[model samples]
Target: MFKYVYSLVFCIILGISPSFSQHTEEHAAATTAGHEEEKFDIGGMIMHHIADEHGWEFTHGVKLPLPIILYTADRGIEVFSSSRLDHGQVYNDYKNEHEHIVRVNADGTVNEAIHPMDFSITKNVATLMLGALLLILIFTSVSKGYVQNKGKAPKGIQSFLEPLIVYMRDEVVKPSIGKNYGKYFPYLLTLFFFIFINNLLGLLPGGANLTGNIAITLVLALITFLITNLSANKYYWKHILLPNTPKWMWVIMIPVEVVGVLMKPLSLMIRLFANITAGHIIMLSLFGLIFIFKSWAVAPAIGVFALFMSAIELLVAFLQAFIFTLLTSMYIGSAIEEHHAEEHH
Candidate 1:
């Protein structure tokens, strides 16, 4: 078991070492340009690190350009490599600016009049795909283990994930959704692990901000909202639409309840987006300390601070995933909750 774990650790490092070396070289190059004092553009650096891009940048000069797909009335569908944009330089009347791929006029300016629907597979999109693939591979392996080792002790990845899965089912789903929890076990499990894995992935250097993306969080929250409403019993709707209150209070109370229906998902969306984005910003800012100081003496202090934060981030990643899943389960529970009537003797 130890050997297997060590091998896995080694493979992960082997995968990341190339990017680390590339980043180191690039940082060195940037700092040693003819002995001139380099002014660190702190805001630019932070935003660049956090923002989505058309390419996956390993370092200064090393990037994997993804495909750019656009649709405009003039052009039915234009498919091309992102490299043609040349990192925001106009290409074939299209350009990428501030992560927004837009059409450019002949005179090298944004052509706002000509809007094109961008359907490009960007860095964040690529990372999302990677996360999905990893999730599939992991669950598939675990399922195979269950089939092959029936009635035997769990081993390998099964051992690692089984407890967590069971906890999610027993503690989270059961407590929240009660008797009907079985129906939502799969979705709750998937949501917990998917968010947890993506959160961890965002911690990696050169990693994509998958969960930090608003679109991703919005979709996740939307799904929760839909499920909550769709699974809602008539009793739940009665409480929302026609609360057991004074008839005179119905006018105000009903609106409040209606607003709450919308607020639940909105809160979920903002919570995930804000937490993930803040984590990235805080980490980047800490790393930026060395650049701001322009001195090697602060490197040790900054490194220590950053290391501490990274450790906290690991905990936070699991925590955020748990909170989201727990709240979702609670919402579903509320929706499907059954009311019992009192019996008089």
Candidate 2:
């Protein structure tokens, strides 16, 4: 178990080491640059670290600039490296403002009138892509292992993920969705691994807060919304439209039921977004204490607490994934459940 944990951590480092190295290098530069020590802004650092950006700082004075694709009315489209706008520099009559690309006027201000469509792959997007690719690679290898060891015991990554797969299927999804669980198992499994992996990545030293981002959470919730409603049996809609309430109360009950329908997905969105974002914010804030105090002594205490929080966050990563999958299964079950009207007694 400890070996597995160590291996997971090692893979995480290999996945994010380049970006982490440069983030540390950035902080290093900020502290040791030129003259007197500057006052550390804990809030700013936390926000900056958590927020998505344009380029990957792979190392000291090095970056893997992602493509910056923009489309405008006059100019159909343009693609270029984000490096062109590094260090507040201008590129092709445009500048990056807080990771946003916009037209620059000749007078050196943003041309607000010109709204260009940005289709660039930001930091979070890149992280999502990387996470997805990693999942593909992992599951692919596991699939191959299954074939190679047909009658033998599971080996390597296959062994590692088998228990998790079985647990989710047998314990969570099966129980939650009952007989129809198999149909949705694939999606739920994919969702679980995607969120779980990304959450773990976000907890890493320089990982992008991909799962913490509201946009990502919102999209996931919307997907759940679609799946729940689209596959819903007549009983589900009937419950919302014609609840077991007095006829006189239909006016109030109907509106409330309608709102509840929308709130399902809304709650999912806010819960995941708020929880993950809050965790990142708290973790970053805790670590910022060391620099804020400007003392070597602060490191030990903060480090211990940060370690504790790291463990909590690690649990949270898995917990959040489970909660999401469990809730989704429940929602799906509720929608498709066979409802028999109460017999008059």
Compare the candidates by lDDT and give the number of the best one: 2
Error of 2 at 10 (Å): 7.8
Clashes of each: 0, 0
RMSD of each: 5.1, 4.8
Give the alpha carbon lDDT tens digit for every residue of 1-345 in model 1.
111110011123222211121123223433344644446666777677777888888667778989999999998899998888874578788888877888888888888899999999998899889877777777777788788889999999878767777777788889999998878877877787778877777777677778988999999999999999999999899999988889999999999999999999999999989998888888777766766776778888877887777777777778889999999999999999988464111
Q: Each model's TM-score? A: 0.88, 0.88
Model 2, 1-345: lDDT tens digits are 111111122355334211223123224433355645556667666677778889865334656789999999999899999999988898889899888889999888999899989999988989999887777777777778778999999988778777878888899888888899878888888888888888888876567888889999999999999999999998889888987888899899999989988998898888888888888888777766666676679888877887777777877888898899899999998888887666233
The runs of at least 3 residues in candidate 1 whose Cα sits more than 4 Å from the true structure, single-residue gaps closed, are 1-38, 341-345
Q: What TM-score number comes out for model 2? A: 0.88
| lDDT on C-alpha atoms for all candidate structures | 0.78, 0.78
Error of 2 at 31 (Å): 18
**Cand. 1 Cα-lDDT:** 0.78
Candidate 1 is scored at a TM of 0.88
